[model samples]
Target chain A: LAKTTQPISMDSYEGQEVNITCSHNNIATNDYITWYQQFPSQGPRFIIQGYKTKVTNEVASLFIPADRKSSTLSLPRVSLSDTAVYYCLVGETSSGGSYIPTFGRGTSLIVHP
Target chain B: DTAVSQTPKYLVTQMGNDKSIKCEQNLGHDTMYWYKQDSKKFLKIMFSYNNKELIINETVPNRFSPKSPDKAHLNLHINSLELGDSAVYFCASSPPTSGNTIYFGEGSWLTVV
Candidate 1:
């Protein structure tokens, strides 16, 4: 399992882009970086996953450098509803094809008006 | 219809009480997990079951037992709950593909009095 480090919190205004970076220095060759979003009383929702380079979804975009040591999650045009905690996870598949993604102390993003 | 649903969205109990949280995923996924989010908002994986078999069991207490009767269900039973057990419990399931998207249930808020 790879341990990830991220900012504790971030502040942004509505309509602005928010980017959260995660550092996983000891990432394995087969490990993948994934980002999740959690609201106040809901479960964490999957945002994006990537190995290297960049991957974009309808919700967010994940950018991973070639070194694979760090990745960034970009949320475009943030709104008040985007205020939530973002988790950085590095997952490794076990022999039985099980993926137990471990989450760190997520970066709480507060989107203001 | 939600893909993953858990019963008792809110649970309030006294100390030393035992409670169970049932989770069902209709996403046709074979892997399920139980994660605990503390008050400080740190998500930790407690148990994981794949194809109705226990695969990942973290260093959680024995009082926390995860039962997977089938591929679509995973229930968590906590015995002799304490004040420290007051947190949010999330049930998540993933598809057979490793390191892919994972769906989480609307957490069960457990408040121990």
Candidate 2:
């Protein structure tokens, strides 16, 4: 499995754009970078994912470079509710032929008023 | 309808006891997973099941057993629960079409006292 590195924490104000970057230098060929948002006392929710380039959804956007070694999740117009831990995961196949999701330490984003 | 749902959203059990967290997904996904989030806020993959078969079993202890009775249900049973077992356990599922995208349940907060 590919290991990802990201900021431990980030602080932003409401209505601002927040970008969280993740680095996975040893990403495999079939690896796909995905991001998830987790709120306090709740489960993590899927925010966005992309193989390469950019993929946008109503909640967030994902940008991956050509190398696929790194990816970024961009959340526009941040609000206090956006304050949560954001996880960056690189998916890979396991020996049992199932996709294993190993979540590492994520970036905790704190949106201020 | 909830894409992924977990029962007993909060569980407060005594140590040396056994408990189970039940999960169900209506998304018709073929894969399900169980993850543990400790107080430090690190989410770790405990197990994964594909089509009712155990696939990815992480370094978790044998006390943590994941059972998949069908394609849409994955239940986690923890035996002789210790204080370390007190954390948030999340259940997730992903469709066959995407290996990286997953939907998560509200989570089961287990407090071992």
Candidate 3:
């Protein structure tokens, strides 16, 4: 599995845009970058995923540059409820095999009102 | 309906006791996983099973045993639990190919006194 690096913590005010970046310099060829959001007492929820370029959903947007060495998750107009730990994972897909993606200490985003 | 459901949302037991956390997913997924989240809120994968077969087994303790009766259910049994075992255990499931977007159940908080 490819290891990922992200900020330990970030702070953002309500109605502001927050971007959390993750670096995976040794990302594999078939690796896809995915992000998950975890609240205090709840399970982690899938936020966004991308292989390259940009992928947007109703909740967040994922931007991956051409190098694919890093990706960023952008949350627009954040609210206090959006404060959660965001995990960045790089999925390693081998030739017709199952692989489990590893999770690191995610970026804890604190959205303050 | 809850896609993934775990029984006994909170469990408190003394050290050297044995306990099990039952999990069931109604999403018709073929793969399920067990993860442990520590007090510092770092999520770690313990084990994974696909179609009733063990696939991913991390460096978890031998006291932690996972059993999958079928694809939709995975139960974790911990024997002779210790104080360090007091943490939130989460059950998750996902499609075989869509490994990036895993659905996690509300965790089972275990307190080993």
| TM-score of chain A, every prediction, order shown | 0.91, 0.92, 0.91
lDDT of 2: 0.89
What is the number of residue pairs that collide in model 2?
A: 0
lDDT of 1 by residue, B1-113 (tens): 99999999999999999999999999999899999999889998998988998998887999999999899999999999999999999999997555778899999999999
lDDT of candidate 3 over B1-113, digit per residue (tens):
99999988999999999999999999999889999999988888888899999888887999999999989899999999999999999999988664358999999999999
lDDT of each: 0.90, 0.89, 0.89
Per-residue lDDT of model 2, residues B12-60, tens digit only: 9999999999999999888899999888889888888889988889889
DockQ scores for all predicted structures = 0.71, 0.67, 0.61
The TM-score of candidate 3 is 0.95
Stretches of candidate 3 above 4 Å error?
A92-97
Between prediction 2 and prediction 3, the one with superior TM-score is 3
Task: Give residue B65's lDDT in candidate 1 (0 to 100).
Answer: 95
| Candidate 1: stretches off by over 4 Å | A92-98
Comparison by lDDT, 1 against 2, better one: 1
Candidate 3 chain B worst ten-residue window by lDDT: B94-103
Q: Estimate each model's TM-score.
A: 0.94, 0.94, 0.95
